[model samples]
Target: MTHRTTTGTAAPESGAAVPAVSRTDLPGGIRVLTERVPGVRSVALGIWIAIGSRDENPDQAGAAHYLEHLLFKGTGRRTATGIAEEMDAVGGELNAFTAKEHTCYYAHVLDEDMPMALDVLADVVTNAELAHTDVELERGVVLEEIAMRDDDPEDLLGELFDETLFDEHPLGLPIVGSEESIRGMSRDTLFDFWRGEYTTPRMVVAAAGNLDHAHVADLAAKALTDAASRFPTGVPVGPRSGASGLLRPRRALALRSDDSEQSHLMLGVPGLNRHDPRRTVLSVLNSALGGGLSSRLFQEVRERRGLAYQVYSSHASYADAGTLSVYAGCAPERLGEVVGVVRDVLAGVAADGLTEAEVVRAKGSMRGGLVLGMEDTASRMNRLGRSELDHGRQRSVAESLERIDAVTPEQVSALAAELLDVPLTAAVVGPYDDESELPGALQDLA
Candidate 1:
């Protein structure tokens, strides 16, 4: 079948060079995107699948991640050991990760080895054996992973926080399925999930570094030939969108008792979704509030009073929902003071917004971070895949920087006021057995 290709280049900033980006639509609705970077001897290739943990039914919890592990076990054409040895023989890296929204199987190799990299990745993603024995073996590994998460205070706290904020929503569930879910997951269930979700239209093959777009597209087409034949022709799936229906905090507090000396606390409110135009404003607000050492929370909670050893604020933007949260770890005895200070800081921001100078610094930080982060092929490859998957198109660096620079102090202040005013949801992981034992400020949240 004839394939249609389209190409474009990122707009370079003044006196700067940017990579040329291109896309190809192949048979079976598979999309291949490539970015050609100059002066790089290596290529970063990734097979990005849109299916993630949130897409699974309750019974299929953690199936996406479990399938990620099984895919590397072996394929029809190669043994697991052979897959490892081939990549290692060329000093290349092969790995995969599953997230709440997507999964990626990627490889980093010398540009001269792009063919082998593409072929290996395609084979693994499309032709996984998913043997019953492998499923059983991987089940134990996933259970151990869940145990590991439970053992870590901060990790457990994050899960608890999500549960408090999102309630019974799929987003609230742990990406690494619960211990019960993994044990009960049968081989047929996982195989069905793999077959249903890992389709050509749901996949994007992206590569960045020293390579030709046409060459990469051709290689991808050749590599996925047999796999494409199995699926019916379709258009690429659009970016995920839907109302999360999470308009308010489900609960005021979630606490997990752990006998740790330091307490981990995460207090947050729902923020904007990924498609919000004011995301730039929220980013600026987050930066001034807790993004760096100069951030308000850092100075107030750590530097001014020495109440906590580490403190920061962060935000997560999903397709239809997002969160703005602050996390601090400190001595168990200092939990009350830490919570008070964080509350005060957030209140102050909500009432007045960031200062003009703070907004300027935040914008500069955002711009610098954006440029410096793209210096590597891996980062570029990731950006290409995420942009295509998240927005269905590439956004130029110049455009992003412009958006950041255009954010004014007023915009940051307004966004801060709007988001921070929501009723707060809190999570704590420490030596507190119940809500009554928590600090007064935390108890007040409940």
Candidate 2:
């Protein structure tokens, strides 16, 4: 196997200099990327797999997440308890999560323990012993998790909104498989998925904080040796791209009637994909609209009217499609007023965009958040992994801040006109029997 290396440093900022990032592509398509933080002793390392729930076939709804839990159950050299004990001995943290497009197994340890951390993480990802008992054990656990999500109004509302907006696309499916699918999943099916999708070419190793790029790459290469040898040489998978063939406003309203204390409502329209150049503009607009406490939704819906205790707008970008939505929880009787206020707020922004002052404040907020959030090693590692998986390139903090600063009011307005002025999709979870019992504003949206 051969190696290719590249290095780049970000432009310096005020207090601390920006860290330098480097990448090494090894034979068999495994890529390792690292960022060296100057004043930190802890290292955050992750093995990022490119397959996620969205990659699952219909019958395999929760296979990716199931694999996440099963990987921690046992591996070739360590039992689940042993894995926990070793990390605890080092006072380190080891965990993992499955997303729409990827899954990550990560650890945080003192820099000196990085080699041990990398080895354990690699073992968990590549050498899991997915026993039948473990599969059954985790199936019950995942089902309980789904039940927990159902019990949370906000969580259930998010799922409902995605279903309404994305229609029948896999992106609309819950990360946790439904009860039927979970019960039906067999051990062999999961093992096959793991062997097929968890290849070196579909993986990235990222580490940050008080680490050397070459040493980290060396550790990764050694740690992943067994897995790397199993596959023939291949090229790393490019970033996910292409249209999300979703029909907009597939259904205007999706409602789940529950006798809860408050009504949960989500209203939104189709949004730009992750690759859209206008995404930064959308970010700035989202900030001004609902990204923070001073955002328009908070001011109009909560501060002034006292309509609801919780109200905000958020946007999510996936590989091919995205969503921009507003969420508000209020008394069942007050759902109408809340909907009216949110609709008016979005309509006003769509019609007139944001003021120059709002845009400036949004940019400053974004810039500060970006810099401050990177104070931890975990955040830095996440940035490296997500950048490589999503765009196949690293974007520096300086470049990000510059892009945020460059967004003009005109650009934001143009995007808002394009994204927010369309037909809206709505999802409701509250004490309502059907659409007829809902407020007229929501019905009008439908």
Candidate 3:
């Protein structure tokens, strides 16, 4: 069986069938979202928390990510080694990640092992010991992580792009804070941040596999019973609502001299937010622009001219704002030619838009991506958690596919014009000693 919309009710936007999804708000304000998929013996469970890097203040910086590491270090009942051994004994995989807007601690295990997964997840998330020695040890690890990122040209360029594009906004900060920030982060500071942010209202537990919704709900409820009083009123905190103040877009050029063999560049403009109706159209537009080998940017910059070895287009959408960008990694000497070709392709698309054939191909690719992504329990669990957290409602797969099918060429063109007509921001990381050495096209873009 496929996934469902949720328990409260199915809000099917299309006549096609949908999975029997269930959502329950527990007595302590925890949200349980479950989808039962047949023929899958393994279950994927994730506890999604709304606190992420964007939720932190300047001083708090990487506290959210720090907590992710510390939680796995040890809990009240399980030492770090014990936690690892238990998961290994069950042959289950437990992992977690921190993002700009959320953090997730997830596990992939057999259906029968669901009890152990829930217990361990609840203990680590709610009752972590965050000992001082572990804090100091993990601090060194996070610093090495930051250092590793610094050594990667592409990763560094992306961080630089965000810093330049978003300016002072918290969204601009990297998921792993800087060396200075990580070095200064104290154990007490992280402990306090964890206590304040890890609330019932800010959390959601999601599972998908061959499991019953009511049973999963009960397991999660019992696992989290000790923390119930933390939410005395049992009032759901609801989705994040308010102005993110990310509207201010700083259009400029940023250069980070890496003395690398190739120049990595991203030229982009502000795009749509998560809730924008035209986001679907933007997806189609992105595909046609540079999403695949058949895309315009790839064809013009890599296929025909062979100006760059790699060239593509991508975009990111946050709650408040987003970005659409084209990336090209080429020889430093060929940087000018690469930038010119990419710019020309973008300008051409903005002026004339994509052909009907291109739009059709993009839509098909998008539809395939949507359907193929749900072939596993882990992906389905992620979809359930993210949809409930982001939109406050689960959109059915059929309905989503229908929306993609309905995106007309006119819709794509309009969105392209709206997003591409603005002044662009460019970020380059490579062997450039001074800004004057940049290509004329890149300088003009700047």
TM-score per model over all chains: 0.97, 0.96, 0.96
The backbone clash count of each candidate, in order, is 0, 0, 4
Candidate 3 deviation (Cα RMSD): 2.8
All-Cα superposition RMSD per candidate: 2.2, 2.6, 2.8
**Residue 236 error, candidate 1, Å:** 0.3
TM-score of 3: 0.96
Candidate 1 Cα deviation (angstroms), residue 267? 0.4
- Model 2 per-residue lDDT at 198: 98
Across 66-154, the per-residue lDDT of candidate 2 in tens digits comes to: 89899999998999999999999999999999999999999999999999999999999999999999998998998999899889999
| Each prediction's whole-model lDDT (CA) | 0.90, 0.90, 0.87
Output the lDDT of residue 364, model 2.
92
Q: Candidate 1 — worst ten consecutive residues by lDDT sum? A: 10-19
Global CA lDDT of candidate 2, please? 0.90
Clashing pairs in 1: none
Candidate 2 C-alpha RMSD relative to the actual structure: 2.6
